[model samples]
Target: MHTESQLARLHTADLLAQADAHRIAAAAKPPVELRTRVGWTLVELGLRLASAPGPVPATA
Candidate 1:
């Protein structure tokens, strides 16, 4: 009986933890428009960095 109670309590705690984690994740996620803009900005920055010229080698 005590073991069963302990198990139930543990199960409840786990469910509560999962709910909290889901709520936090939902809250932390950016809106679609903001995510899109940030994604595009990162892509543009990556392209610019990729296309940037390297330093010229010094002639001996």
Candidate 2:
């Protein structure tokens, strides 16, 4: 069986690892403003596509 100290150390290590992982993940994501801009741009493009008129007829 493990000692109480060892268990405590293991728990601390696990918490530190989780914190490090979260930090790295947060760094890897785009900034909130940029993400919001891209999201709005995509929505505008989708709206324009949906409202597009049918293709024009070709002259003989």
Candidate 3:
């Protein structure tokens, strides 16, 4: 249970980090092509994180 909680927290942090990165990139006003690439990459990362398997059950 403890390990599962920790994993959850880590996943949450990862998501938050991704969000921050997206926000920073959006605000930087980079070239359209670069911005689009970054945006897609961030979106893909978020999707992968969201779809990732749940934490494994801790062994006794």
Evaluate all candidate structures by whole-model CA lDDT and list the values in order. Answer: 0.94, 0.96, 0.92
Model 2, span 1-60: residue lDDT tens: 999999999999999999999999999987889788999999999999989997989999
Model 3 lDDT at residue 38:
95
| Cα lDDT tens digits for candidate 3, 1-60 | 569889999999999999999999899975669788899999999999999998999999
**lDDT by residue for model 1 over 1-60, one digit each (tens)?**
569889999999999999999999999987679788999999999999999998989999
Between candidates 1 and 2, the lDDT winner = 2
Q: Which stretches of candidate 3 lie over 4 Å from their true place?
A: 30-60
Q: Each model's TM-score?
A: 0.48, 0.55, 0.45
Which model, 1 or 2, shows the larger TM-score? 2
Worst 10 residues of 1 by lDDT: 29-38
Q: List the residue pairs that clash in candidate 2.
A: none
Task: Order the candidate numbers by lDDT, best to worst.
Answer: 2, 1, 3
- Candidate 2 vs 3: which has more TM-score: 2
Q: Residue 25, candidate 1: how far off, in angstroms?
A: 0.4
Report the Cα RMSD per candidate: 5.3, 6.7, 20.2
